[model samples]
Structure formats: C-alpha cells, structure tokens
Target: MSTYKAPLADIRFALYDVLGAEALFARLGFADASRDIVDAVLDEGARFNETVLAPLNRIGDEVGCVYDKTSGDVTTPPGFKQAYAQYVDGGWAGLTSPIEFGGQGMPHAAGVPLKEMIDAANLAWGNFPLLSHGATEALLHHGEAWQQEVFLKALVDGRWTGTMCLTEPHCGTDLGLLKTRATPNADGSHAVNGTKIFITAGEHDFTDNIVHLVLARLPDAPAGSKGISLFIVPKFKVGKDGVVGERNGVRCGAIEHKMGIHGSATCVINFDDAQGWLIGEPNKGLAAMFTMMNTARLAVGLQGLGLADRAYQNALRYARERLQGRSLSGPKQPDKPADPIIVHPDVRRMLLTQKALTEGGRLLGYHAATLVDVVGHGADEQERQQADALLGFVTPIVKACLTEWGVECTYHALQCFGGHGYIAEHGMEQLARDARITTLYEGTTGIQALDLMGRKVMQLQGAGLRVFLGMIEAFCKEQEGNEALHEFVAPLRAKAGEWQQLTISIGQRAVANADEVGAAAYDYLFYSGYVALAYWWARSVAAAETSSQSDAFKAAKRETARFYFARILPRTQAHAAAIGSGAASLMSMDVTHFGG
Candidate 1:
C-alpha cells in the first residue's frame, strides 16, 4: 500500500525561513503557539495519517459506502468508524477551529500543512473530515447563537460531521434555476424540502450525527438567487440538553457511483420537511454560502497539491528501485543488470517537473493559509483588510491553477511508472482519477477564469492586481543582490508585466463587447495561474539560495526552480497570446460547421 511521510523539514523551511510564518503568527497574537507546539502538532498529524488513515484508503475505495434502502442506514467501509474515532480523539478535526466552540483555535497556517499531509496520504479518507471543517467555517461565520451552541461544538469536536447541500440535479452552477424550497412553520423553525445531489459525505456512519448547511428558497421569497436562504438541517435533531433526539426529515435518497474517491459518500439527499433553522438573513444565502464556498475552493486546491505530491513521491521511489535500461553514455553501475530509471535524462526531467510544481504549490498553499490568518487576526485593521483583498483576488487562481497543475503533474508521475501505472496495485491510476475532480468542482476552471477576469480584475479596476504586482516588485528588489536568483526573478517579472498588459487589454475589449469576455476568460485565467506559479517559484528559488553551502537542499530547490522556468512557466506565453487574440474564432463557428 502507498504511504505518506509528511515533508516536515520542507514545511519548516517554507514556514519559518521563506514566508516568516512564525514571526507573523506571533504578531497576530498567536504567541502561545511557538515552534515547539507547531512541531508537535505536525508530528502527531503525520503519525495519525500514516498509521490510522492512509492504510484504509484502498480498503475504503474497494468496499466503499453501502446504503440499505429499507433500513435507511449507511455503513462505511471497514475500519472507517474506528479511524474516525481516532481522528476525533486526537483532536485533529478542530486544529483550526475557534476555542469558544470546543476547538483548539490554531492558526490557519498551522492547519493547512496538516491538511495537506492527510490529503496526500489518502484523498478519499481525507474528504470525510474536510467537508466537516468547511461546514464549521460556514456555521461560525453565518450561523446564529442557538445554532452555534448546538451544532458547532459537535462539529468542532468531530462527534458530528457536516456536508454542504448544493448542486441539484437540474442546476449545478446555475443556482438561479434551483428548485429547493424551505417553508416557514408556525414555530421558529422552517421545513426544508429539496433534493441535493453530489453532496460529499452526505450520508455516513463515521459520526453520531450529521449537520447539513443547505441552500434553499423560502415559500414567499423572490425568484432566482436573490430568494435563496441558508439553513442548518441536521440528520438527527438535537434536544435542549445537547443530545441527539428524534430522526429528522432528512435522509439519503441515493449515493452517487463515481469514477474516483469512492470512499467518500456522495449522496442525493432528500429533505422532506426537514426541520431547520435559518442562518444569516433571508434572500442573502448566496452571499453567506460564498464564505464556505471560498474556503472549500482553497481546500480543493490543496487537494490537488496533495495528490501531486503523493504521485511524485511514489514515482520517484519507483524510479530509484525499478532498474531499466543502461545509461545512454555508459553504465555507471557496471556490476548491476541495469541502471535505475532515475539515471535517465528524460526520467529526471519528468521527476524534476513534478518536484518543481508540487514544491512550489506547497509554498503557495501555505502563503494563502497565512493570508487567511492575517485577514482574521492581523495586528492592524489595514493589514487585515489588505490580506482580505489579496486573498479574495487570488482564491480563484489558487484553486484553478494549482488543481490544473496537479492533474498535469499526476499524469507525468503516472507516465514515469510506465505500464505499472495502468494497474490498480500501483495506485497511480487512482491518484490521477481522484485529482480529475479538483479542476471540475468548487467551480470549474472556466468559472474561475471568469471570476478572475470578469469579477476580480475588471471589476476591481486594477486594485487587487496592483497589490499582487507590488509584492512581486518588492521581492525582485530584495533579491536583486542575489546572483543565483536573478535569472529566475527577471523572467518572472517580465511574465508578470506581460500578463498585466494582456489583462488590461482583455478588460478593455470585454467592456466594449460582452462576448469578448466569454471568449478570452479561459485563456486569461490560465495565464494568470501560470504567472502566479512563476512568482511563487522565483521566491522559492531565492529562499533556497540562502541556505548553507554544505546543505544539498539548496541545490534541489535551484534545480526545481530551473525546471519550472524552462518547462512549466513557458506555457503562459501561449495562454496570454490566446487571451489577446480575441473571442471571434471560438464563437464564430456554427454548431453544424464540423459535426453532424
């Protein structure tokens, strides 16, 4: 079975050495959380994921979740319940949750790396707790007093799990056409009646109770998204004493048979007059849900990074162990039957590409996490606001770019294993399949592009763009003295400048012509994603250069940075050119032009 060892040293280097996460943590009033505490948490997280959760990945995928229609009960794969119990016992579920609700209240920076470790170990098992964390975030942000007291504690403590109920059969992205309805009862509660499809962790036996943060429309509400309201609909009703009471009106109608992540129970939830309490204000559910949606989007990006890391590790190990053809120049190991695959230039290329992207993604992911912490707990309001604006602008890029790169990285990793990759035993196929969804869900790549070009960039009038460019410029200025980093830094700055010009041009055309935005949106998003990754890689290279001369780690960092610039970063050129080419060619062709 494939197992994961958390990249502790790399994480420390990124957090303390590169990003200055420790200083930021202290400044943000997280003074109690020192380096020792962080190390202990990470160590515990690594052990738990490797020993308890990682081993069950394949088992869960094989057995999956079974639902008995007559009994209305869901049984998880073997050992899942025990593993979940262990997860709760270790307090892994509340690593970043608020202390007021029985949580540890650790900073987001601390939580994110731990999340990556678990996700890399087992994407399927990792999902069960992930959804719950998202739900807790939503509830804490939008849930009312009574609702928080009842549901938040259970969720934070991992005694209960949660799922977001969106994406109906007829409507997925277009929530304006959704048919779910919530009717107000004589009591203070509302009766929710709707069918929510593609609900991850919708039905499971991992926890005693399941809390659903659902989106539905009130009976007398206005039409479209404006009418939508958020609700806390639980599987089992909670009594005043904080115990599970009667079975609620919610139940799993059916479970989705998916291509990957089979261990996660994706359900068609039937809410037949399920008693629920209102969260936030009526007709503002969409806005409220965006809070959870945005967090989920970032988490989804980490999912991509995690899978790519695992794929790279597995492939790297295989390359070192599986002897293949002799060296093209000459045999280095003359006594052996064949040289290790890692000795080949092409194999090295593939592994280096994976290393560059995955490592770069880890740094970027941690940066985003720290941004969230700064936004929430920064020393000053101005700093908080800046962090908020920057994070809001980059969330789409982080989600779309990282996941897209993740799938590409996984593909290369699988190819490294050759025929063994196609087989189930190797687990490469599963990693690829699991990664495929990250780009599709939490808003598709096209949707993210539209959000970036249409909403974030064009709408902000370069405010957010200016912030990003300013940061890049400052970094370049700081590294100007470093000879080794100059090569990577200069190209990154040029790419950023080119992308900025392209973005402005696209915005200009999009304003005059609505159709142009649609045509240029996808390419523009890809360009932005590429440029953002390049910036991250450049900074990583600079940090890696500062390490002690005797340490070979700096060499690894430089090699990965070189790989990124030579192989991966060049793709942005094509994406930018496509964005600048306008929307006519793609939209001009008729439906019957080439197809029957």
Candidate 2:
C-alpha cells in the first residue's frame, strides 16, 4: 500500500511565510494563537494523523463500516474509535470552538493545517467528525442558550459527534420539496418526523449520542424554501441538564454500499416523531442552515486539497522508483537496465500538473480559512463585512475547483502508475474513488456555479468579485518594481482586469437573456479559480524569494510557479472563450432534439 505523510514544510510556508497568517491572527484579536502555540499544534496534528490515522486508512477502506439493520446501529471499522479517542484526549475537537464552551478558542486559520492533515491521513474517518464544525457553527449562531448548554458542549468537546440532516430522498438540493415535519408540543419542543438520506456520521459507534441539525417544516408554515425551519435532534434524548436519556424515535434504516469512503457511514436516517428543539425563528431554517453549509463548503474544499496532495505524493514516489524505458535523451541511470519514469518528459508533465494544482490549491484553500478568521474577528466592521463578501465570492470557486482538480490530479496520479495504479494493492484507485465524491457532495459543482454567477455576481452586484480584483491589483502595484516577480505579476494584473471585464460582459448579456447565467456559470467558476490561483502563485514565488527557507525549497517554489503560469494559467483562456460564446447555443437546442 502507498504510504502517507503530511506536507509540513509546504503547509508551514503557506500559512506563515506566504500568507503572513501569524500577524493576521494577532491583529484579529487571536492573541493566544502565537506562532509557537500554532506551530506546536501543527506538529502534534501531524504526528497524530500520520502515526495513528494513516495506518488505519487502508484497513478502514478494506473492512468498511458494519451496520446492524435489526438494531439500527453502525459499527465503524476497527481503530477508528480508538483514533477518535486520542483526538478527543488531545483536545483537537474544540481547537477553534469558543472558549466559553469548553474549547481552546484558537483562530479558525490555525485549524486549517490540522484539518488538511486529518483529510490526507484518512478522509473516511475524517468524515465522522467533519460535520461537527458545521454543527457547532449552526448551534453557536442560531441555537438557544439552553440548547447550547445541552447539545453544543458535547459536540464541541467531542463527547458526541454531529450530523447535518439536509438532504432527503425526495429532495436533495431543493429543500422546498422536503416532506419532513416538525409538530409543536406543549413543552416547547417539537416532534420531528421524516427520513433524511446521505447523512454522514448519522449513526456511529464512536459516540453514544449523535447531535443532528435537521431541517423540517412547521404545521402552519408557508410553502417552499422560505418556510423551512431548523431543529436539533439527537440519537438519544437529553434534558435541560445535559444528561443522556431514553433513545429517541430516530433510527438508522440503512447504510449506502457504494463507490468510496466505505469506512464512512452514509446513512439513511428516519426520524419517527423524534424529539427536537426549534433553532432560530420559524420559517428561517434555510438561512440558519447556511451557517452550517458555508462552513461545510470550505471544509469540503480542504478535503479536495488534502486528497490531491496525497495522490501527488504517492505519484512522485512511484515515478522516482519505478524504472521504465530509458529517456529519449539517454539513460540517466546507466547502472540500471532502464531509467526511472521521472526521466521521461511525459511523466514530468503529469507530475508537474499534480504539483502545480496541489500547491496552488493549498494557498487558495488556506487563504479562504484566513478570510473566515477575518470575517469573525476583524477589528473594524467594514473590514469584517469586506472579508465576508470576499469569502462568499471565493467559497464556490474554492469548493468547485479544488474538487474538480482533486478528481483531475488523482486521475493523473493513477496514470503515472500505468496498469499498477488500477490495482487495489497500490491504493491509487481508492484515492481516485474518494476524490470523486467531494465534487458531488456539499453542493455539486453545478450548484456552486449557479450560486457564483446567478447570486454572488449578478444578484449581489459582484461585491465579492470587486474585493478580490482589488487585492490582485494592489498586489501587482506593490510588486511592480520587483523585477524578479515581473514574470507572474504582469500577467496576473492583466488577468484581474480581464476578470472584471468578463464579469461586466456577463452582466450585460444576462440583462437580455437569463439563460446566459447558467451557460456562463460553469466556465466562469473555473475562470475565476484559475486567475485566483495565479495571484496566489505569484505571491508564493514572491514570498519564497525572501523567506529563510532552504535553497532547494525556494527553487522548487519558483520553478513550480513558472510551470503553473506557463501551463495551467492558460486554462483560463479556454474558460473565458467558452464564457464569451454566450448561452444561445445552449438554449437554442430543443429538448426533443437533444438526442440528435
């Protein structure tokens, strides 16, 4: 099986050197989140993930999760429960949760490295606690004080895991069609009744009680999305004092037997008049749920980044060791019968593709995390609002691009192994399979595209886009005199202008035809993503040139930045051209003529 290791050096460089995360954290009132403390956290997170979780990845995939249909219980693969225990013991669960609720209260950015480590080590196991962040966000933002005391503490301290119950069998993206009902009781609680599908960690052996942030409808509520309400339901009932009580009406009907992340239970949860408490105001569940969804969307982006990094790491190792045909330039390893695959230009292309995407994606994902911190704790209200808008703009790009690139990177990684990658023993296939789901879940790439083009850019009038373009322009101006950065800075500045023009053009066409948004959305998301990476890549090169990093490290950053600009950045051209084509061709085709 291929081994896994956290890319600590690259992670550190991105967080501290490239992003200047420490200074930002200090300025945002995260005084306790000093470089030393955050560094130590990274070290321990790496050790725990690499030693405890990495070894379990193969076993988890192999054994998968076991479900007792009769009892409605799910038993996670062996070693998962133990690793989670270690995680809780180490205080990793509440690393970024509020201090008042039994948490360490670190900056959100500080948790990004730890999250990346967990995902790279074991994504399936990571899914078990993944929704906890969203659950915490939902409760912290919308739940009642008593609900926080009862449910939030357990989830924060890792005494219990959490799940976001959004998708139902009848409705996936359209929550308005959901049939889940929440009937009011005289005791001020609600009885939730309905079935939720694809509920990650819906039922697990790691914790006794699973806190479910469910979406349902009130009896007298209006129709459609606006009428939905959010509720807190648990596997086992609890009281105001926080003591676990009798089992609730909720039960795991079944677990999905499918493509990947087999160790993570994707359960069909049934709430048969389950005891629940209302969260936020009536008919405002969708808005409240966005609090959780926004968190999950960013975390899903990190999942893609982590898996891509893992795939790249293994592919690089294989290219160096797996001897193949001699290079056209002549055998570099004359002592061996044939040269290693790394000597071949085609192999280099694939490797470099993986490297460029993985590294550039790291900066993109981490920068979003930093924005989360700024949105939450910026000193000035205007600064916080601007950060929030920027975060909204990039969230879709980060989610869609990282995931689509995750699938792309893993495919290239497997191809690097030739026939060997297809086999289970090498573990490349599992990574590929696992990467597929990231794009599908947490809102599909298509959903994110519409969100970006239809809502963020057009409806919100490009508030987030303007902020991002300003950053790129300001960066280019700041580094104009630095000749070493001219190669990347010049093109990046031009791309920023093109990005603005592209947005304006799309807005103009959208005024005449509404279908223009859908047609331009997918291409526009990728276009935005590639240009965003261009800015980050430029910044990465500039940061590496002056940092105290090793000579080899510095050179690698510079060369990779060059490779990205030369090969990957041009992908934006294709996307832009496609966007320029307008929506006529797409909408002109009649439904009856689709087969033709």
Candidate 3:
C-alpha cells in the first residue's frame, strides 16, 4: 500500500521563504495568522493527515462508498464517518473560513498547506470538505443574509457538507447546454427539478445534510448561459434558526462506478421540485456559480499536487529498498544480492523528475493560494484587484499544468516500482487511477486552455497577463546582481520576455483568424505553465541559498532546480513551436477525415 509523509519543510519554504506569504498575511491584516500560529497549524495538520487520513486511504479505495437505492442514502467507506467526526471535532472544516461564522478565520495561505496534507494523504476523503469550502464561498459572497445565517454556518462548523451541482447528463463544461429547470413558487423559494451528474459529495452519511449550490434556469430566462441562475438546495430542510429539519426533495439516484476515487461518492442526483432559494440575481446564476467554480478549480489544482507528492513518497521509498540490477558506475550495495534501484541513473532520473515536478507544482499552488488571500483581504481595493487579476491569469495554468503533471509524475512513480506497481497490493496503481481524474474533472485541460487563451487573454485584452508579466519582470530585475542566482535568474529573464512576446504574437494571429486561438490554446497554456514554474524554481533556488538550511537540504533544492531548468523548462520550446505553427494544420482537417 502507498505511504504518505507530509513534505513540511518544502511546504514551509514555498510559503514563507519563496512566496513571502508571511509579509503578505501581515499586510493583508490577517492578525490571527501570526508566524507561531501558522507553524502550529501546519504541524498539527501534518500529524492528522499523515496519521488518521493516510491509513484510511487504501481502505476507502477497497470498500468504497455504499449506496442504498431503496432509501436514497449513501454510506461512506468504513472508518470514513468516524474520521470525519474527528475532523469536525478538531475544528478543521473552517480552517480558512470567516470569523463571523464558526471558523478560525485564518488567511487562505495558512490553510493551503493543511489542505495539501489532507489531499496528499487521502484525496477521496479530502474531497468531502473541499466541496463545502466552495459552497461557503458562494453563500458568503452571493447568498442572502438570511441564507448565510441559515446554511453557511453549518458548512463552516462542519455540521454539514456541500456540493457544487453544475453538471447534467447533457452537459459538463458547457454551462449553456445544461437542461436543469427551476420554477417560481408562491413563497420566496423556487422548485428546482434537475438531474446533476458527477456530483462529488452529493450524498453521504458523514454529515446530516449536504448543501448543493445548483444551477438551473427560470421560465422567463433567456437562451444559453445568460439565462441560467444559481440556487441553494439543501439535502435536508433547515429552519430559520439554523436547525436541521425534514429531508428535502433532492435525492441521490445512484453513484457512479468509476475507475478511481471510489472512496468519494460521485452521484447522480435527482432534484424533484426541491425547495431552493435564489443565490444571486435572476439570470445571473452563472456569475454566482463562478463564485463557487473558481474556488473549486483551485481546490482541484491542489488535489493534483497532493497526489503527486504522495505518489513520490511511496515510489522513492520503494526505489531505495528494492534490489535491482547493478548501477552503471558500480554496485553501491556490495553485500546485497543486487544494488538498490536508487543507485541506477535511470532510477534516479525518474525520482528526480517526480521531485522536481511535485515541489514546483506545490510552489505554483502556494503562490496562487497567497493571491487568493490577497484578493479577499488585502488592505486596499487596488491591491485586491491586482491580486485578482494575477490570480485569474495563473489559475488556469495552475489547474491545467499541475493536474497534467500529476498524471505524468504518478506514471513515473509507478514505473519506478516496476512489475510490483502493476499489482494492487503496492497501491502504486491506485495513485495512477486517482491522478487520471484530476485532469478530466473540475475542468478538463482543454477547457482550461480555452478559458486562458480565449476569455482571459484575448477577450480581457491581456489584463491579467500584463499583471503577471510585471511581477516576473520585477523579480528578474531584483536577481540581476546576485552572482549566485545568475544561473537561474538569466534564463528566467529570457523566458519572461519570450512569454510576453508569445502572447502578443498569438493575439495578432488570432485577430486575423479566430481559429488561431483554439489551435494554439492548449500549447500556449503549457508554454505559460512551464515559464511560470521556471520563475518559481528560480525563486526557490535563490531562497534556499540565503536560508540557514542544512547543507544536504540546500544541495537537494539546488540540484533539483538545476535539473528542472536543464530538463523540464525546455518543454516550453516544443509548446512554443506548436503555437507558432498557426491554425491551418488544425483547421484544414475536415470532420470526415477525423476517422476512417
């Protein structure tokens, strides 16, 4: 089975030294998130996830979630409910929620590492509250005052869970194609009738109720996405006093039989005239649902990071212990039947690839997390808006790049385990299966790519891109004189310039032929992602050099940074070439030519 050890030191390095989140939290007026408090939170979170959640991962996968069709009830894998009870008792659910509710009111950055720990240990279990956090984001931002009082606290207090009900049988990524319907009632509420598929945590025995932030259309609504509206549909009825009451009309019709994350209850939910209230203005549900969708997008990004790091831990352990062919240089373990696998250069390559990708991905996620905190609680409107722009620019890159890397890194991890990885006993294959879904869900890489290139870059006129570019430019200038960082800094400087030029070139090509955008969208996203990570890796090396870190630790960071720069960063070259190829190659292919 897989084993997980929280990479606390690297996480701290990314948060404090590399990203400067300490100063960021202080500047944002996060008075409760002092250095001591943050450290304590990280340590405590690591202990819980590594000890309690990690052990249940394989069990959850084996037993999975059980559903009762007769009663429309779902039972989580054994030990899940108890673990969730412990999680609630420990006040973990509201780690980053507002103080007005029953929460710690910590800054979002402080909670990110804690989340990483949970997700790395057990993704299926971690998803339970992830959807809740997204729901709380929607309600806190767009819900009515009475609705906040009635439902938000329950989510914050971990008394109930939540789900983002967006996908229907007919549509997934395209919100305009959704067929869910909402009818006006005599009272203030609406009767929501829809079947939302692929609903994570839609129904579970872990909590008394589940709050579904569902999207449906009203009778008078316009066609397509503009006509959609969001509603707060709870699994159980709640009173004005925030008391749980009778069951609502919503029910889980069935759970999916999927390739992975069996521990998570991915359900087919049927809403039969469920009583729900409008979350935001009519015909503006997509906008309100975005309040939740954006949060979910980032959360899924972290999920990918968590799984990659966990897979690395298990694979690295196996490499050091499992005997194999002699190293090219010499047999390091002379006394053993064969040298350890880690002695081989090929084995080391795979291990280093995992390390480089995992650490870099963590930094990417951490930077985005800090920006989320900034956008929410920065001292001034200007700072918040700028942060929001930068966050929007990087969110797609973070979501797509990290999840894709998760798939790649997990494959490397499993490959290192050889024949044993193919077996279920070692648990390496489960990581592969779990990693597979991260790319496909939340938003597919293709969808994120289009959003990045089409909506944010071209449509917004590179507003977010300019903000991110400015930050990179400033960082590159700062490291100019430092002889030690010159190796890392020089390449980043060139990459930054190229990144901006690439955007301009794409914009020009797109103006002549809109198909240019779609043709280059995926490649452009990857190019942007690699360049973004290159900047982070450069920052990590600079930070490691200045810190009082141990020689071994500093050496590892420097070596990994070098490997990333030399090996991984060049991937941008191929992506750039693809982007430069224009739309002709893609657009010329006729629909009939797609298959024989």
Candidate 4:
C-alpha cells in the first residue's frame, strides 16, 4: 500500500503561478497574506497532514466511530480526538477567519489550498473542522453581535464544532417538506423540536459543544420553504458568555452505517424542545443558511480535488513500481524481468486522465475560493458585488462538476491497480469508497445541475455567465498573438463563444418548455465545467511556458495539456449534443407506463 503524501508542490503551483494568489491577495485588501506566510503555512500544514492525519485514514475506516448507546455519546476513531487537539493547538483552525474572532485574518483563498491538503490526508478527520468553517460563515453573516462574539469565537477557537442541520427523514433536497418546528418562548428563544438526519460530525466526542444551525418552521409563518427559520441549537445549553451549562434536549439517536467515510459520524439528532435562538430574521432562514451552504458547496468541491490528487499520487506510484509486461517499444527496462506497467500506453492513458482532472480541478477550485475572498473582503462595494455574482454563478457548476469528475478519476486510479484495488488492505478501494459520498451529500449532482441551469442561468439572466465569459475572453485575448500559445488560444476562444451561444439557446428553448431546463441542465453543467477547465488548463500551460521552472516540469505540464485538450475537452461535444436534444424524448415517457 502506498502512503498518502501531501501534494505541496502542485498546491503551490495552483496558488502562486496559476492563481497568482500573492498579487491577488495584496490587491484585494489582504496585506497580511504575504507569500512568505502562505508558504510557511502550506509547508507546516502539509507536514501535519502527512505525518499526523494521513496515517489515521485507514484507522478511521477500520475502527469507524463508536456510539455509546447508554450515554448517547459518539466517540471518534482512536487517535482522532488527539489529532484534533494538535490541530487546535497549532492555531490551524483560525487560519483565515477574522482577527477579532481569533483568526489569522488571511485571505480565504490562501486557506482554501491548505484545506485541500487536509481533506486529501483524511477526509473523515477533515469533516470535523469543515462544518465549523461553514457555520462560522453563516453566523458571521446573519448572527447578532453578541451571538457572533460568543459562538463565532468558540468555533474559530476550536472549542466547538458546527453542523448544518438541514435534512430530515422524509426530505433531502426539498426544504419545504421539512417538519421541524420551533415554538417561541418568553425568554426571547425558541423551543426547537425535530429530528435531523445525516448530520456529519453532528454528535462527536471531539469537543464539549456542537453548534447546530437548524431549519424549522414557526407557527405564525407562511407555508413551505418561506416559513422556515434558522436557529442556533446547541448540544448543551450555554450562558450569555458562551459558558457550557446543562445538557440541552438534543441527543444522538443513532449513528448511520455507511459504505464510506465510516469514521465520519453521520447521526440522527433528536431535538426535543431544545432551547434555541433565531439566527436571522424569521422567515429568512433559507436565505441566511445559504451563507453556509455556499461555503459548504465550494468546500465539497475541494473534496473532489483532494480525493483525485491522493488517488492519482498512489496510482502513479503503483504504476511505476508494479512490473507487469514488456512495453510495445520493447526492452526499455532490459535490466528487469519485465517492464513496469507505466510503459504501457493504456496505463499512460489512465495516469494522464487522473493528472489532467486533478490539476485542472485544483485550478478551478482554488479560483472559486479566490472569488470568495474577493466577495467577503474586497476593498469596495462594487468589487464585492461583482465578485458575489461570479461566485454565485460558479458555485453550482463547481460543486457538481468537480465531484462527478472526482468519482470518475478515482475509478480510473483504482482501475490502474487492477484486481488488487478492489480488495481491502491495499487502501485503493478505501479512496473509492470515500469519494462516493461527495456527490450525494451537500447536494446531489442532479440538484446542482438544476440549480446551475435554473437559478444561476435562467433566473439571473446569465449575470454569472457574463462575468465568467469575460474572464475567458480576457485570457484568450492575451494569448492571441503569442506563438507558443496559438494552439490553446484558438480552441479556448471557440469554446467560450460556443458556451455563451449554448446558454442563450437553452434559455430560449426553456421558455417554451420548462422541462427543457431539466433536460438540458445536467448536460449544460458538464459542458460548462469542461470548457471552464479548458480555459484554466490553457492558462496553466501559458504560465509554464514563461515560468522559471525546470525543463522536466514544464514539459510534463505541456504534455498533460495536450492530453487534456485531445482527450478530455472532447467530452463537451457529447454534452452539447445532448443539450440540443431538448426535452421531448424525456417528456414522452409516461409515468404510469414505467415499471417498478
């Protein structure tokens, strides 16, 4: 089995070269995010993940999280709590949060790359802090001053962890169907009563408190989603100063048994009239919750990138080490009994696919984080609004595309391992199993696609698309006359134009038939994602051509760029055809005629 190693160099390339994070950070009002600080953080983060977190991955899967029925306490896998303690002591928890709340006050973009490393090391372990980051966002945005002072600091200080309590037994994607209730009390708090399911890190022994941002309905409110309100419901009651008091009415009814990420405690949380405070204004909870949901969607995208990077690294190592047969060219490894599998063309295809997706996905994911930084901390109102529009537009596409691509890349990586990957103990199968949940949780691929095509594209009138297209156009223009970038420039320019035209076409068709949105949604998302990656890959190749790096690194990048353009970018053609097919074929099928 190959041990996981943090891909620090690739991460640096994404941050410094392709993203130009230092220059971007300085321009975006983040003077503290110097290159020296970023690199030091990355180095130490990689070390902690490699030495402390990576080794606990299999341990997490094997032991899983233990549930104590007698006390309703969920204990994480062995060494998990200790590792978290180490994480907190190192001040890693507040890397990019606000300074007043105990954070380092760096640009969120710089923290995002480091987050990718943590997820790659141990996704289950990473889950504990991931939700906390999101909760911090939600609370910081919508919570009152006192709430922020009390809850946000605890979260940022790692004294507490957070969970987005959105789902219920009957409702996964439909928030309108949620039946959780919050009754007003005389003390300006509400009594929350409901059961939230599939809550990650919902009930864990890692911390003294679990802050739940729950969605429920009030008696006097309107019907459906509009009536729902957000609440701050803790596992334990707290005083005004955030001191832990008595246990609240919340309990972990059970921990779910799952196919992957066994270490993550997916719990059924029962809130029996738990004392809670309204997060934002009543009936505006969904709007407020999005502050965290958007944070999570982007974070989940990095999960895909992280999984792909780790799988590729191990697969590449195995491909070079495992000797199988002679190369088609013959005798390249005459000293060995047989040539390594890396000499085979098919093997190269798999490796190249993994490399292309992993690297391209990083550029996309990190860029989104930078947009988030701009949205949150940009110097002026106009800049923040523009960044917000672009960020909103790409969140769904990034969430859906990266995860769908992640599963595909992990499969290819495991396929490179042959039959050995399917069995346990080799650790290849573990990564595949772990990656399966990225698309399911947060939001499924279908939901993300619909959000992209419906909410982001149609409703917003392509506001986000216009910003994104402008970026592609700007980059394409810069490379137009450069001899070294001619191949990339023409194709990228064409794809951007084709994508804009496709969006307009889809919108027109959807006007006549609403089903056209659903029919074309998935295809449109993938189509958008592929073209987006093409832009980033082109930009990356341009960076490599001019960088002061070694010849071998530059050549590898150029070769990978060729592979992506020739093999991967062609995927957009099929998506475009499918999008053009309209909704007729899908609508033609009768519901009553379908077999059970």
**lDDT assessment of candidate 1:** 0.85
Question: What residue pairs are clashing in model 3?
Answer: none
Best model per lDDT: 2
| Per-candidate total of colliding backbone pairs | 0, 0, 0, 0
Q: Model 2, stretches more than 4 Å misplaced? A: none
lDDT of 1 by residue, 88-203 (tens): 98888898998899988889998888888888887888888988988998889888787789898889999899898989999999998889898898877889998999999998
Off by over 4 Å in 4: none
lDDT of 3 by residue, 105-145 (tens): 99888998988888889999998999999999988998888
Clashing pairs in 1: none
List RMSD in Å for every model shown: 1.4, 0.9, 1.2, 1.0
lDDT on C-alpha atoms for all candidate structures: 0.85, 0.93, 0.90, 0.90
Please provide TM-scores, in order, for all candidate models, with all chains considered together.
0.97, 0.99, 0.98, 0.99
Candidate 3, poorest ten consecutive residues by summed lDDT: 236-245
Runs in model 3 deviating more than 4 A are 241-243
